[model samples]
Structures are given as C-alpha cells and as structure tokens.
Target: MSAPIQLRPDETFILNVGPQHPATHGVLRVKMQMDGEYIVKSETVLGYVHRMHEKMGENRTYAQFLPNLSRLDYLGALGYTHGHVLAIERAAGIEVPERAEYIRAITVELNRVASHLFWFGAFVMDLGGFSPLMYAIQDREHILDMLEAVTGARLTYCYYRFGGLYNDVDDNFIEAAKRFIPRMRKSLKKYDALVTGNIIFRKRLEGIAPVSAEMCRKYGATGPVARGSGINFDVRKNEPYSVYPEFDFDIPVYHECDSLARYRVRMDEMEQSLRIIEQGLEKLPDGPFMAEKKPKTIKLPVGDYYQAVETARGSFGIRIVSDGDKNAYRLKLRSPTYSNMHLFDEACEGMLIMDALAFMGSLDLVIPEIDR
Candidate 1:
C-alpha cells in the first residue's frame, strides 16, 4: 500500500451529499469537494437505483418490455412509455386510430401536469419551504385518481400499448378531464401568487448556477434545462409526432439560465399542457381506440430505429435494433437527466452548498432514469 497523504487543516475536504439525502430526492450522491460552505468541485455518483432497463428491453418482447419504461422516470412515466410505443410502431409502420391518438394526448398531458406539480412541490421543499409540497400533492392526486380510474394504476402505468391504447376512455374520464383544466388553471394562478414572486424564493434562485445556451449544447441537456437557457427546442414542436401536431401550444423559454428560469419554464409548461388537453378534448374524433388489423405480437425491421419525445424533464429517446425478431437485438435509452447531470460537476464549482443544491433541484433529475 502507498503511504497515506494527509492534508493540512486549511485544505478542502470531501462531503458526500446523498444516496439518502432528502434534498437529492433519490439515490443520487454528490462527491462534493468543499471549502467551508462553498463547493470547490463536485462529482455526481449514480447507479444506486440502476435496473439495467436497456438489458431488460433486450430480454423481453417489445410488448413485454413496455411497462419497464415507466420505471425509468416514476414522475414522468407516460412520456417514456409513449416514446417506446412510438419507436416500435413507427419502425413497423403500424397505424393507430385517430381517437386513440387523442386519448393518448389527453392522458400524456395529464401525466406531464402531474409530474410538474410534484416537481414544483418537491423543488420548493428542497429550498426549505414545505407547504408547497402539501398543495402540489393535493392537486397531483386528482390527476392520479383520474388516470387510475381507467389505467388501473397511478404511478407506473402501462395503459398505452403498441399501435394503440389498451382501453377507450369513458364518459366519466372526459367529464373529469373537462373539470380538471379549469381547476388546474386556478391552482396555477394560486401557485404564482404563493411561490413565484416570494423574495426568499427569488433570492435563492435568480442568479445561481447560470447555464449558458452553449453550455446546454455541450452537455446535451434537454427539456427545461435547455429552454431555461433560451435554446428554443422541444421534441413535441421541433419534431412533431402523434396528435401533438394537431394541438396548439407554446414552448416556454427563458434566457436567464438560472434556477428561477428553469422554474418558470416548468410552471409555464403546465399551462401549455392544459392548452393541449383542452384542444384534444375539443377535437377528439369518434373512432376505434386501437388500430384494426394490428398484430397481437410485435416484430420489427432488421435495421435500427429511433424515436424521441418531450417528457416532463426533456427529451426521452429509445433506440432499438432488430434481427427480424420479437425481441430487440439491442436497446438503448437516452435519458435527459443523464445528459443534464453531466454539467453539474463543472457548473457547481465555487458555488455555495445551498445554492448548488437549489441548482440541482432546478435540473429535475430522476436518478433511475439516469442510471438506466
């Protein structure tokens, strides 16, 4: 063994911030090199929640692997699942019913809203405020209950299937959705009043951890992280798929490139999702929910295929390679958090520990998604 090297009393020491820390919100651990209350440098340590989701995909049939996507990002499960189904269906050239696309849009947007609500609460709580969590959960439960009424589960839902949805929505689901839009709008206005303008919240965020547009491109960060930095890109708009093209919504972008900017993106995104859900309901056509003559089993072309979707976090993409078989030869999941997290080590350098944590919360990381 080599001789132990000791540092002098004034040297920086390491602080392990998680793997159980509440501020992390998951099993993410930050190896932070600290000097007093400031971080000199940091390294994010992942894999605490790794499930090998890509390997899981390779081991199962396309249909069988569908549910696993949900486990990748628990808060934003539907978007991950949506990208999977879309990848498979697009490569196979399978057609979905018009009605199913509308319902999918409705449910997926609901999921997005639910994910953002939870993030809003958890993020504010990360900065030491707790009441937002209570209110946010209160609203999120309404979404979960509605999704569960049809999908049969709240969190990890496999309600969507290859080529279409497993079931058509009922009258109750539609009416509940109509009621939810206005209720959510009122709640959003309440949140703006309660949290957005608070001097403490603004002080905690405004100029901390500034990410440049060039920095976002360098790290391949997507979703609100890129938008917060004023890079105007969203897969739903930039690369339209499903019924996203039929609906009208704006991509919220802020050039401030700080925690507050990312916060505003998510808050504004909830409103846009509401606009999509409302438009989906208004233009919801009457037809079959699943494509007629679609095969019960899935088999893909010999070449590789890729699909991307704008998840609650950012872009979640799935790439599949096939050998004309029911199972994928290779499966690769491109998670936005994984790309977004790369910038943290460099970004947090010389930041006060509290501001670094707040900056991380602004990233909206889902640890399992990254580890996968």
Candidate 2:
C-alpha cells in the first residue's frame, strides 16, 4: 500500500484579458489562472467577429465574392487578395501576364510594410507607449494614399482580378512610390531610435513569451512567430510563387524567441520587403495588366485547388473546391493567426498577466482573421 500522494498547494488567481480590451486589437478574450502575477493556465475565446466567410464563398460566384478576401485581414489587403486570386486562377487554369505578376508582388509588398507599421505602433501602445504609434501612423498614411490612388480604397481593397490586376498602374503611381520609399527609409531610422532602442520598451518585452523552434513548428506557426524562434521558412523563399523567385531579398530570422525578438523580426522583414519593392520597380515589365481572355461568367472546373501566400501576420491559405459550377462547392481559409494562437496556452504558462498581454501582442493575432 502506497502512502497518499501529497500535492503541493500554490496560490493562484484568475485574470481575463478581454473581449473589449485595448491590447486585443479585435474581439479576443483570454482567461488565465495565475499564481500571484504569473499565469498557470490560459484559454482563448474567439468568434466575436465571425462572419462565416467561407460559407459565403460557397454561395457567391467567384467574381461576386471578391470583396470578401480583404475583409479577413483588412490591414494586408493585397496579401489577402493575392491568396484568393491565386487560388481561383489555379482552379480555372488561367495565366497572369508578366507585368501583372510584377505589379502584384509590388502592391502586396507595400501592403505588408503598411501592416507591419501599424502592428509596430499598436504593439508599443500596448506597453503604454503612445508617441511611436502616432509617428508610425504618419508613415502608414503615406502608404494608404499610394494604395488608394490605384485601388480607390484605403483599408479593404478589392483590387486583384481572377488572373491578374484589375487595372494597370500609371506612371504617376510608380513615381509617387519611388518618392515615398526614400522618405520612408528616413522615417524607419527614427522609429528605431525612438522605440526599438528605448530602455523602457526593451525592458517590457525582453524574456516575455519565450517559445522554442520545436514549439513553433508543432503549433504550425509561420511568419515572424516562427522566424522569432529561429525557423527560416518563408513561403516566398521556401516555396517560391509568382515573381518572388526572380526577386532578391533576405528571409530575416531571430533566435531570441521572445517578444522583443518577434518585434525585431517584423521590423527587419519590413526592411527586406522594402528592398523587394525597389527591385520589383527596377524590373517592371511592359505588358497587359489583366488577362485579355478573362471570362465574365467563370464556370470553374470540378476540382480542388490550394493556394498559400505570406501575409504580414503570417502565411494565409485558401482552399477552393469547385463542382464544375458557377459557384464553389466549398471554400476553406487556413489563416495564420489560428495556427499562431494555438501556441499561446503553452507560452503563457507561468507568465504574468501583463506578460500574457505582451505575448498576445507579439504574436500579432488579428481576431477577424481567426474568426473568419
């Protein structure tokens, strides 16, 4: 007979980090049980902003449902648009023009920069910094203006077509972007000095949410989350698509595996994206923007097609199943935030409630992307 097993008792408390909390960015609720200020367990509650977007895709025609793409991650409109368009084009066996492919790469890269800038500001703001948010927004507004001139929308742009872009970029747009890049480079320098080097900011982020490379892969995390953990897997580089293979850029990796590492990864990725954009501009080809044979009635073949693109948050995938009909039979979205959030329970354990929020911010979870 064995003696009764004794269990150690530890003081613990519960903390809720909000469905309406400022740091969440959208409707996300995290319930955490804590030992003093450190978390012992945590659960994330979602679906507050669910729109059943995949179901809508099954009912609506491919052309009619274009608007839904941007709504998933409104911050990276080009990234979302590229994923859907690539999926549909592959399903329909359409070829995008050379010029169109270059344009797609450029616009999507610009959108990635804008999205990262917004995240940089918001992440800092979560740690009680405000001025950097304002400066970051100022840089982001220039990107919005540049995108709006071509797409006619700032946030939720529905610009990409089935096989190519909706329209060609004019000389003025390219010139504006060329002018904007130099100014943006100078601004990024200031952002580094102001926020990245600040002692308080570094203190708040260091050693919070430390995840290993094994944990990142097990959780199916990508983008900065995986990169922060020393994984060199960028869809653009590992699985080259469109004009990405032709472009020269670096896949930034950080071994820190902490909140500051994730933050630095994104910042470094922004610099790399800027380089991609510049190279794309220099190599811009002259050709049609949209496929000349684009059909008004897209009757997709009976097959399933999967497409993946790297977004600001991470890799976004679209799975379209067509039944040789005008409308798709099934549409599935494999969003990055969903995969990234799965690691939260493991990362937040034994961390403080404040550190948990910082961890959440570091992952850069866009709730609508998860909920959709």
Top candidate on TM-score is: 1
lDDT tens digits by residue: candidate 1, 1-372: 997887677899899999899888899999998998889889888899888888888899999998899999999898999999999889999998999889998999999999999999999999888999999999999999999998988999999988799999999999999999999999999999999999999999999899999999999999999999999999999999998989879999999999999999999999999999999989999989888878778889799899999999999888899999999999999999999999999999999999999999999988888998
Where model 2 places Cα greater than 4 Å from the true spot, the runs are 1-11
Give RMSD (Å) of candidate 2 vs. truth.
4.6
Candidate 2 colliding pairs, count: 0
TM of each candidate vs. truth? 0.97, 0.96
- For every model in order, what is the number of clashing pairs? 1, 0
Global lDDT of each candidate: 0.93, 0.89
lDDT of residue 12 for candidate 1: 92
Q: Model 2 over residues 144-260: C-alpha lDDT tens digits?
A: 998999998999998899878878899988998898788889988999989988898888888778999999888899999999999998999887888999988999999999999
State the weakest 10-residue window (summed lDDT) of model 2. 5-14
